[model samples]
Target chain A: MSDVFGVGVIGAGPVTQAIHLPTLARMPDRFRVTAIMDVDEPVAESVAGRVGARHSTSADDLIGDPGVDVVAVCSPHRFHAEQVEAACYAGKAAVLCEKPLALTVADAERVAQVSRETGVPVIVGAMHTFDPGWLGAKANWGDLQETVRVVNSSIVLPWNARYEDWATQILRRPPPGEPVADDALSRSVAVRDAVLGLAVHNLPHVRHFLPDVESVDWAESVDPYGYLVTIRGGGIIARLLGNMHGYWKPSWTLDAWAADQSLHVEFPPSYVQAGSSVATLTSDTQTRRFGGVEANGYEAEWLRVWELAAGIVPQGEDLQATVDDLIYAVRIADAAADLVRGEHARDRVR
Target chain B: MTEFADRPHLVTLPSGPAHRDIAAALASLPRSFRPGAGEDAIVYVTGDDDWPASVEHALSVARRAIVVIQPGYAQPSTVLRLAERAATDSVPVMIDYAFASNPAVVLAAAAWSAAVEPTGILDVTSRHAGDGTGPMAVLLDQLAALHSLVGPVRTIRQLHIDGDAHSAVVAIPVGGGVITATLLGARTELGSRGSRVRWLGPTEALELEVPHAGTAGPGYSRHVTTEGEQLAPTIYENAHRATLARLSRHLEAGAGRCDDLTTLAGHLELVPREHPSRSASQRTSDQRAN
Candidate 1:
């Protein structure tokens, strides 16, 4: 193996610092941070200085960099489809974009379509799926039979920016674009997308590990302070929750069951935990822990993506399961939108 | 609306005749903060409706923070405002759904909290679906989910779900007296999951003799059911003792000592019933009569 995998990152925000940068940094033999792109030259330069990557002012520049073997899109939700499409079009070996895949189903489909056309491996950033603890979780699924009627997932995020400052700053900079369409009041709808972004990350894990979900009836409880969802699928009644107020809470948590066995995971909330970069898994039978690179959760995900890119992991629908989860996420998001618009009774929809 | 002229610290108005006594009791609570008591207390709304701004105003004055108990009827804008205010004031705010059986509220609360500071959100939930599900099913799910999030802190000292479809009580193992937490769910006509779990501090099979509606002596033997069969009191005691035995594992692991448990539990204590205030003429007459 080469001393480094020569990776290029396209975003200079918390996610990049916490996950992408440090993950590559930890495995000097498997990956290397080669370049980064952000609209704000100074911010991009600062991140490049810390991660030892060259700075670029535009996405095109980062993609065209000769040292860049892979491109990581860590921008806002809206930019993912376009960035991933561009990376694949450039004949990059792999394309990894942050979750939700895209803000709209149309864009996500477009991105997937383009990647298929280009024959580039596109891995959606669903880090929890690659988590060793989740691997341990799968090993212990049989123990979760007795108490297994419901799965509750809690991904309580901190006050992280909805978009990297550079992205918004770029939007405001040159050729002023049309005002982005979003919810008018309290920016609740805009924030709802972020919830979907977070959900897409964990939903795949739930779907992959739990018994097959036969049908899903989900509703979004629109509290501006937070969002709550109740999903009844595969005879399991699961609740996925996100909040921005109350008290600081762990960012990712999973509680599931077997008839008499239980599994519990409590990790540090978002960036703080990401900074420390560790995953902890506890069950009735045993406890397992993993991760501690400054690279955050993204590093492990990057390795998984590298595996796929290297053809070590087979590709197909199984690889596209994240897309299925993303679609489920869309259905959930649309339902939430309906509830917020008063088109449907909140409880009736569920 | 009754004039609250005399109740200065009362945050909630007595809604109907059924709640009048509880309201009077709330009106008389000592306003001063108690030592070891958390500065925050959850003020829950028992019904579904848009929270009135007056609710926020009341919380702002009475305490440094507040959490509205809006389960099935939470509005996104309203939730956002509550969170924004809480964030601005540097005070924690929570939205509670202790009565929600629907998963929608849970999802919404989770989403709302994730959009803000992670710590700003706390979800308190049950592990099982209470769709007239059998007691064992409910207990099993509840224990599983509870252990998943915060490892089980309390041991089972008493298990009671009445076959009479009346009231039932369970004992939660605490430091001192047997904390007998009772459930009021069985008493309702709708069979709603409105269980009131109370901790009856330390005792040994200490059966309190209460006068039944007509009968006397031990109204009921505080019956214990296992797999739905009423075990003899001696047998029940043995089972209870055994269950408490498992909790020692947690005690050894330093688990059940979470500070939030006692603080959250303390709010469940029944407030003292208040005596009616006398008018000037009534006071004068009462003194003279005395």
Candidate 2:
């Protein structure tokens, strides 16, 4: 593979239209967009034309192209596992996919199994895990895992347009997906999707403070929007909240508490490089704030993919950890759905 | 304001939490407060004596009375018994919740209740430095202020909690509107302050922050309206004073029905204990009719 790898992205939707394109545009020396694929031909062509890349309605064509060294998967939830597996088997230098790894633990395991078999490094993108501030907390986190009392993760998101507007000015966006109707099949799918999409980012992030989740105590879907999840076990407890339809400004913070010390990390919204996440360490004697990092997690994730692409990562970089994070998110989501189901059952009895 | 002019004597408990501030708040108003009751009536019972009987005797002699409580440290049954006696004896009773008179909470409650739509969410938090049974005092104050902002909560959901932090969302369906309260307890900030009561209203957002409870200084506040920003003016520097002022008004109006027992049971019922949330919840259910 050349120093500058030619990329073939499978989905030309929002993640590509807004995030990855702007990110790749900034790193001209290491990466280049060679092809774009989408089921919607116009969207694929329109995005491909902007980056001077070829457009194809068939994802297989894009994945099989000789000029495409790195294959990035940014498709819908269902296609993640199969697409990444195909990229790995196709002898691509690197495979990058957005979160959930796959929707279920079984699928995530399959993705990991395929990656291990093919030996083509796969990057599962949950950007906050790669955040500089979070990483700094991980580095400076002395025995927090053993001594931690609680890990509280809160995110108050108003609307995506508030932050997404800062990243890309999309005059014409993709058509909206259909809302899940209130039915059995749809409800099951909705619960899983809510986990895969929303809680996946946070559950794994909280794991940095308290890695082993002994059991989830409680989980619920808030009235109209949001998920409230609590995990407790092994002398540590974690609470994660994600409100999709909040009417206030966006607020995101992850705080970990020890007996005398705690680490608080505040993250800016995704896609936008507003500022690095700020981490503050407070002990009995002194309080210190860390703001030294430059690159945001979005950029850092791309750089990590580059590291995997360049074979510069250290030994024992098990891709299974990424799969585990996704599984952890799925388990929490499943627990939340079960809680909602139990509430429904109780309501019926009442 | 000569409601208690003849027997201008007020009896109170230990001058801690909101008691001192309540006294100061009363002192600021004309003919609202009395310094002496001619008896040392603030019985430091420590769950040892008949607190209700003591309160009844004090109220029988004095014109009005105030009971201070730190719900976490004090017995709820003791405080409730005293408040119930004062209410039954037709004596004006001011049972001030922990730091309920903080100016920030007062303003946030007022703003939310006064909104045109009067429907919003209240986020009340306390910064604490303590052991694992964390910030229980602040949690009580938050619940009291939450009651004041909306009404008595009708629905509660324990959303997120851990060793040092406990978060719950409660909704009050009072009159024609519903106001939700989000309560969070933070265990890191060391100052016996750093409490916040924020209201997200239909027309604007009001955030009231208290750095130190019952301090002489005016806690910081910001109101973001559709037009622009407006900072609320401090009425009383301390919330205890505000609570006292409210009690005076209630006594003057001859308002009966003390919320003491119900509020206490509600809190002890709603909040999850460190070890046994289900048992506490069952206790709340069992004693709810009491």
Per-residue lDDT of A1-350 in model 1, one digit per residue for the tens? Answer: 34346788898877787656656666777777889888889989988988777898899989987788788998887788888888888988787887767777777777778877887888877766665555555664554544455466666543344222332233332332232243333233633564585665667756644444443333333232345555545445555665442222234677554333455554444433343324444444555555444444455677777876676775465336666777777776666555444423331353
* Residue B230's lDDT in candidate 1: 27
Worst 10 residues of 2 chain A by lDDT: A171-180
Candidate 2 positional error at A322, Å: 1.1
**TM-score for each of the candidates:** 0.51, 0.82
Q: Which residue ranges in model 1 land beyond 4 Å of their true spot?
A: A1-3, A143-147, A161-191, A209-224, A246-251, A273-296, A314-318, A343-350, B1-123, B127-290
DockQ scores for all predicted structures: 0.03, 0.23
lDDT per residue, candidate 2, B1-290, as tens digits? Answer: 34553333353434324345445655676465565445423221111123344445556665444454444523445556656676676555544443465656666666655652434345566666543234555566677776765567666655454555666666666558655566766565443445767665534666677655445567666776646667877653655555556666676666765565457656655554443444553465457447
Going through the candidates in the order shown, the clash numbers are: 58, 7
Candidate 1 displacement at residue B60 in angstroms: 50
Clashing pairs in 2: B21-B240, B21-B241, B22-B240, B25-B241, B101-B239, B101-B240, B102-B239
Tens digits of per-residue lDDT for model 2, A146-248: 7767677776555565456555566444333444454444444565566667667767777766677787655544333455566766767676666543344
- The residue-by-residue lDDT of candidate 1 on B1-290, one tens digit each, is 22222212223331322134334333333342111212333232322232435345534753433333322212323445555554555443332222221122222223222222211122333322222223332333233222222233244322323221211222333223222222222211211122211111111111111121111112112211112212122211211112122222222343422222122222112111121111322354345559
What docking grade applies to model 1? incorrect
The root-mean-square deviation over C-alpha atoms between each candidate and the true structure, in angstroms, is 20.5, 5.0
lDDT at residue B16 of model 2 (Cα atoms): 29
